[model samples]
Target: MKLFVKDLTVIDSSVLDYSRGIIGQSWLVDIVLHGDLNEQSMILDFGIVKKLIKSTVDELVDHKLIVPAHAKFCDVMSDGAFTYVDAWREHGESIHLACPDQAFALIPTEQITLASLETYLTEQLMLRLPNNVKQLDVKLREEKIDGAEYCYSHGLRKHLGNCQRIAHGHRSTIEILRNDERDSALELSWAERWKDIYLAEHCDMVSGSELSLSRAGMAALTPEHYCFKYQAPQGEFQLAIGKSIVEIMPTETTVENIAQYIADTLAKDCSDALTVFAYEGVGKGAIASA
Candidate 1:
């Protein structure tokens, strides 16, 4: 499927300020984009394209990313389009996106006019048959190491200040082709309470494990709780599973039903989480009522 961005620019021009950070100047909107497809021409489970789009948006609109290197251009602007590139890298296999056309070009941070370029790209993307061609992509275009730093140190007390080692950090330049974990993730994120477990399928799982205790089961606990397991084709990891708690007595219920039911009941019974996962596999339960 093709991705469609309804509006490319946020209309307001006067509200941007340093207090709220650069993201405060960004437009918020629902984004729908396609994942990579396979030999059967089916959408891969990796959600590569989807993640790329959202992450790119996040990079452009979230965290400390709003700071424009060019402070001079912060003024005299009504509109601009901030595009993101989702980068991945492998030796040979990869996915990529390119400018739909060259009509849209990137200006230095100083020349950007807030909503001006954004509005232009927005209207351009909406036009049919590549006439406007303002669409941009989050894709990898190169292979190189991220930048490094050099620190300094003082004598006697041996204080620290400058860099001393070589550090290599960079984003991936390959598009995800298929990943069962993220496939299950994005699908669940869209649904209320739970999503279908195409991910928790008939695979290498222990027989006694409650397959029904959907990993989405954590939603029953807390969206903020860090509880998730992910496996990708190359490398994999889970985050934020610690610092969570689910208050439920499973003596009367099967393990299959316990986690989810507790999640559901906790949602109703407590103002705060009953169980907490402080970090990793470490978990705590039965919080005192306030």
Candidate 2:
């Protein structure tokens, strides 16, 4: 017997890429279980699938940084409670992060692609499944967005949950309305601006010497990078990313603030009212008008 669930959950994370540095991504998960029927004549209860499978996947990858441990340019280390990463781009630029151990999913792969993540997820899931389950299939796919969208990475230091992780991010779509009318051009413009970008707060910025990083991480810095570090309730977190790929905000980078920032920026250019829909990830987002 086979039981399946579509849209099981969405994972929002940042992945270290050999060429692109750190790229934020979001993927929808679909799951299938091949097993014999249990005493209730069911493969697995729908409620259990929602709770167990969804929660498991969330705990593993959501709101975290997914590092390809086997990548030639990626180096990972742990000091009991925290993980440190040094990922270099093909052209000499690099990204470095240090955070709590729970903030990363170090997959044993050369790259973090859909196929690789799915295989890793399936292997992990099987270990926790019931004995009757003979096989499991995991599918990770990006949402089919018909309009302007961009991948961005950020951290919310005030968040009490996993969102406090310094390097996790999202793939989000932007919608804009000018005088209450849809504005595709404006949407596309903002998307281009944020493509594979890191949105950060000015308060988080710090000098390279002030960062809490390993010797290797400190050695990887260049004039072209910006350093950020903070102490949240979870632990100390730090990141050094290339300056060209980051957008420093005067205020917090929460979705609410993002929407307000967009609306306020657009409002400056015209007398017409503007509304901005800024998404943190799939489905849910924040809206603001100015």
lDDT values, one for every candidate: 0.24, 0.90
In terms of lDDT, the poorest run of 10 residues in model 2 is: 15-24
Separate clash counts for every candidate: 34, 0
**lDDT by residue for model 2 (1-290), tens:** 89999999999999888877678898999999999999999888999988998899998899989999998898899999888899878887788888889889999998888999999889999988888899999999888888999999999999998889888899999999998898999999999999989989999999998887778999878788899999999988999999988999899889999899888888888788888999888988999999
Predicted candidate 1, C-alpha RMSD: 22.4
Misplaced by over 4 Å in model 1 are 5-23, 30-38, 42-46, 71-107, 111-290
Q: Encode model 1's per-residue lDDT on 191-261: one tens digit a residue.
A: 22221101111121222122122233322333333222223321221212112111113232222233344
TM match of model 2 to true structure? 0.97
Give me the overall lDDT of model 2: 0.90
The alpha-carbon deviation from the true structure for residue 143 of candidate 1, after best TM-score superposition, in angstroms, is 38
- lDDT for 81 in candidate 2 is 86
